[model samples]
Target: MYLIAIAWMYVVVMMTIAEAASPGGTLLGAFFTLVLYGLLPLSILLYILGTPARKRRIKARQAQEAPAEGHPPSGTSSGVAPDARSQPPAAAQTDSVSPVREES
Candidate 1:
């Protein structure tokens, strides 16, 4: 699916070239609009196909692959409690951060 989108980028570029080289200027204008309209959606689709989505996809896939409760295939974070375990999630702790203590 992702490969299809990636290839579509090249296809769009080639289409642009073809549209430019086309004999009928009206055909070129119509194809140019098509390529313009497709560019944003294609870039977004490609990005989703690429790295950011890949991580979540792999994690979700692994979790689905294993059929056990409380076993989420050991993500970047540990399965244990922050206090019990060595490292804690960033959002979990608040002591290190200070209050604003604003004045009028």
Candidate 2:
């Protein structure tokens, strides 16, 4: 994420440099044009810093995946695996039925 931000900043800086190279209102015009183009890195900067959804998802994902109380996840185990039948099914339940069910 930091790398993305850094790259975004780099693009923004390059844009500012390009704008500086241009003369008169042309530079400013080009600046606005750059903004008009979605490729402008400023949006990415704002999104990385400003968007609540991105922030919340990042926080939630980090929390959900973090190592808990000094116990790491058991990914390297060589022991016998547990029986699958003992565990409950992990399928999603759907409440919405087919349109035909409405008639019934």
Which tens-of-lDDT digit does each residue in 1-104 have in candidate 2?
A: 56766676667657766776766536766567557542555666667676787788997776677555443434423233434654323333346666654464
What is candidate 1's lDDT per residue for 1-104, written digit by digit as tens? 86787687777766776776678646657576556756778877677768777898997887887655555446444554555465677766567666797898
Top model by lDDT, which number?
Answer: 1
Please list the C-alpha lDDT of all candidates, in the order they appear: 0.68, 0.58
Off by over 4 Å in 2: 23-25, 33-104
**Predicted structure 1: lDDT:** 0.68
lDDT of 2: 0.58
Per-residue lDDT value at 18 in model 1: 70
